[model samples]
Target: MAFDERALVRGPQPAVPEIVPYDDGWPDRFEQHRRRIAVALGSRAHEVEHIGSTSVPGLGAKDVVDVLVVLDDPDDEAAYLTDLERAGYELRVREPGHRALRETSGRRVNVHCYAAGDDEITKYRLLREHLRAHEDARRTYEDAKRALAGREWPDMNHYAEAKGPTIHRLLREAGWTGAL
Candidate 1:
């Protein structure tokens, strides 16, 4: 199903762009969220991976931990959303093949929910792993992010969209030939 890009804007927009130095505790924070998500979903959580800038060491980010959770049936929101809500994760974005939840307190987290074998999931993991293994690519990405962060954006989505070219270039260098 083709998703409306506008639907991705379900969350509150940041008033200003904010990018900070890499936090050494990002991995620990991710692990904490991972554990919480695991317990919330139990056996339904097939895979949970830390992605995005925070996942890359020394990469400056918005201090938000991005996590990807692959499930056997992501569309079955009732199976997991309720539990996650009970655990304090507010459902922010809900699309045909994806769902995103944000933690209301403590360290920030974005839990992306996707169906098993979704290409989007694969792309995220591949990009994350590639960045981890290639320092030059990681540096380039950080530079691009830093430059973009200096600009004003109407929302987080706009900021994310502004990073598209650099991201796509990195993905191509990392062996992605599929359409963006």
Candidate 2:
């Protein structure tokens, strides 16, 4: 199936990504949603982790809780997408090997579904763990995010792309060997 990248952009394009101070409640919120997702996905959810900036304590981020759900077969959307839909998560982006969903329960969320053993999964886990253990790196990342958040962006995707370089550098500094 051909993936339409443009379809990922929902609603009017944002002038810039909304970045906010980290909330102390973010972790609790993630835990709450994690349980719900586990219930929704059952055994298909091999692993569900709290990722992104919200997972890092004291790090400022957009007020969205990002969760990474590792499935046995991510491409088999029919097996789990409907389950998420029933749980109030609306599918937003359908890329080649990834899928994104937004929660409709007033709380903001971005659930990233990926196949087990996917390299991107390793990257996300490494970054999150690295940031949690290294204070200096976390501060540096927070500063960069604050700076980038001020710039005007064509859309959310553009804003995300802008952070790629900084993320790559941080990953290297974190001793990531670029291997899955």
**lDDT by residue (tens digit), candidate 2, 63-126:** 8899999987777888899999999898877777888888977748989999988889888988
Which pairs, if any, clash in model 2?
none
Per-residue C-alpha lDDT of model 1 across residues 92-164, encoded as one tens digit per residue: 7777888888897853898999998788887887788889899899889888888888666656667777888
| TM-score top scorer | 1
Superposed model 2: Cα runs more than 4 Å off: 1-4, 7-12, 105-107
Candidate 1 Cα deviation (angstroms), residue 7: 1.0
Tell me the TM-score of model 1: 0.90
TM-scores, one per candidate: 0.90, 0.89
lDDT of each: 0.83, 0.83
* Candidate 1 residue pairs in clash (backbone atoms < 3 Å): none
